[model samples]
Target: MSDYQPKILSGGEHRSDDEIMADYGVSEDSPLVIMELLQRFHVKDIMRSRNIISLTRENTLREAKELMRDNKISGLPILEGKRLFGMVSMNQIIKALEGGWLDDPCQQHMSTSLVVLEEDIPVSIALKYFHNYTFGRFPVLNKEHEFVGILSQRDITSALLKELTSEISKLEGKTEAAVVEQRPVENVKSEWVIPYYSLRQFVIVRNDLANAGKAANEIKRMLKEAGVNSKIVRKVAVAAYELEINVCIHSLGGSLTIVLDTHKVTIIAKDNGPGIKDVDWACQDGTSTANDWIRSMGFGAGMGLSNCKRVADTFNIKSVVPTGTTVICEFNLSA
Candidate 1:
């Protein structure tokens, strides 16, 4: 593993919540969004098995180095039976060689002041630590504080990829159904006093990153042309963008429909699923199941639903495992 470097927090250098939010282009008041996103994911969900490669305090630096090489791993937990002694990494081995302590016992050089995660804690906490620490992995402890397993960034990312694949399958199934229902329809006149005409448009979203945000951008353009209020248009635009990105990143294929009338605008997103296993959890901010690839593209912070909810006057979501998901966001023009 790489050498662990601690982040320094100096006086007058701390960033405020608003500053952090602005840095990320998120709303300043929505810190809970991140918390909600991470609440559903537990450490156990992403931790490697307890049968991890380890070493003993009595082991020599050369042995530790050889073990790491054989296993092709960067860090090893030092343990006495089930109890953790400390942690040793490849960097420590290099340091020991430089200091002519290559034969010294690992306990003398291993890092004892450890940062660890609880088995049941949210993975968000782990993510936070990963952002703050330079360690390649963290030791996981159970309720009794016994070392249970180890978690790495790669493990969390792998779990997310699996979830994304499952969701995409569900979306593909929904796309088949959507095709059957996708036919020409006549517009209905609104009963409102404003004598409004309803306009509806349907766009297909595929899992093509190249065209991810096209549908939402087009929706925004259409709303603007319809003379919608600027504030309302921005809200719809943001919601549409998030939903469209969700389809592109998480679904195999799906459809987004926009219904605009004098009184309100409705955006419906439906996709085949290995649908969401937990609707409430999915709706929380900062709770995303997107893989590392999606995150690498600067997306999938688990804030899609939260952002949509924040802007919409009314929001409804339905999802079923192995089936599909449907999200409806309504914006009242009068509001």
Candidate 2:
């Protein structure tokens, strides 16, 4: 194969070569270092546990803000009994504030459903979540659905950054903001807007991820049934399958909403997992945060996100912890 590599975007993240390895909380020098670090530190020792600030749905708006500031936290889990009701972060609170609903029932205003991580889960998983969503922090929960604590991206980044800088300080090292370099597309519309629409949404289950081929075949059939052109259908099917599997493997559980029209296709994916914290690094090839379980499936090799970017004519992502995330991708249709 030719060594020539065209510049292409990674998932949503774009980081320099050095920064990428560093950002993932992996050792800059060797893969073995990452493995060793992961094994040495269990989730309990590494995860920020206990006194996780929480707000009940019955709590007041003022109370939520107070808890966040008092804890110097960005988000808080909303719990009711032994269940994770939802999450409330400064952003959600701000949305309420901006909407002029300070008196709105916190129950009415707070997020009612949330993405969570178990207490004993691996810290590397949390680190990967942070890397995927570029989150500042993610809420933790116990098996009993008790609020455990929050895993702050800052904490992981700080430790990771320190590790990188420390090593670089002694050797050849420097911090770069990372670059998403790609040749500019020419003679085509790079940007387009979906006027407005809605679609039937489906959650990509773990089972489907395990059998993506079958699922992909089914999706192709669905597109045909929907009357989409073969070329357009292939694009949508591939992109949909890749992204759907990405969620099943990466994010907690995300939705795939199919917006169809005589002239276009819009697929929206909304997730409750931590938002993509690093938009740059996720786009790179050969960079992934998948666990052995996912790797065993022969997926999660940092190619899913990149594949989505390639197949979709347009894509958009909006995410916030405690509030959940949304991804909207569009495909052009021939008249």
Candidate 3:
């Protein structure tokens, strides 16, 4: 929260497959392969859809609390015939008890200011939702806007770990027997390095929404032409686009510079004056200082830095009030 000091967050370090599986550590902040998996998997793929514990609006608060206790859950969606009405949390139950309103209908005490997710959303976006919102679980709806399932962090982590273990084992050429035996990843001392070299800088004009993504698109094209792995290219492209748009909207003006080499692709965004006051707060998802005009154009949803950090192998941000800010996103290519 310091205004003068830089805030840095790094993840997606090239960890061995075994370490990832042991901790079920797959996340949006994981490596290129894991990030790709998140993008490929939808919310429905990991959401709890079967035998979901729910209560109807007509149900009393006492019944809601009983269902939560019996199922060992903290929240329950208020639904009637697959149609979601509201949500009741454990806190509401406690309050009802203290107020002697435990026998009241759930609809009278349920929380209506709900944040929900679509069943078709990617796990990557779902992770962003989890980071942005404090809700322990999100109700999922289908194309017809009917309540379908509930998604939790636990569901995503467990599903991603299983997918990661299987994919990594296959990529490492581990035999079926070795994989079944849970072979140590340290035994495989190998790495694949992609040789590449490029450097480019683009001048971004302030409030230039029309041309904001040009630089990032060029970067994506060059990487594809260079034959970089699709997954790796995707991560770099996403980070690049987010950074490019950030520079265009946030600062008076700025420049985006991209460097590609044997080890990784680095995207640096440097802006003019009017630096951020709290770099730490700015990095968090759903934190924004954007004006209404910018938000109306869909330019600042506060996902810029968060998206860059989620996809980049390493992310760094620095700012000095009235001086400007610089953000660097690096995507590792090796291992």
Model 1 clash pairs are 33-285, 37-286, 37-287, 170-272, 170-273, 170-274, 171-272, 171-273, 174-272
Which candidate do you rate higher for lDDT, 1 or 2? 1
TM-score attained by model 1: 0.49
| Per-residue lDDT of candidate 1, residues 1-335 (tens digit) | 33332222212224554454354444424333233334556999878887898988899888999898888988898887777878898789889879989899998899887887778877655666665567788888877778899999888778766765764675576557655644434545432123455544444545455557776887788788778998999999899889888876676457788878778999998876668888899889899988654675688899999999999999999987777888999999998
Model 2, residue 290: distance off in Å is: 1.0
Question: Any runs in candidate 3 off by more than 4 Å, and if so which?
Answer: 1-30, 174-335
Q: Residues 125-166, candidate 3: write the lDDT tens digits.
A: 677666655778888888776888889999998998898777
Clashes of each: 9, 20, 0
lDDT of 3 at 294: 60
1-335 per-residue lDDT for model 2 (tens digits): 12211121224434443465576545534543344344434445555647566766778777888877887877777665544566777777898778887666576776554455566666555555556664576666665656666667665556555654554452221112111111112432322222343244454433234334444565567678766789988988888877777766666555566766556788776666766666567767878877664675578788877787788888776767656667677899862
Q: What lDDT does each candidate get?
A: 0.74, 0.60, 0.76
Predicted structure with the largest lDDT when compared to the true one: 3
Ranking by lDDT: 3, 1, 2
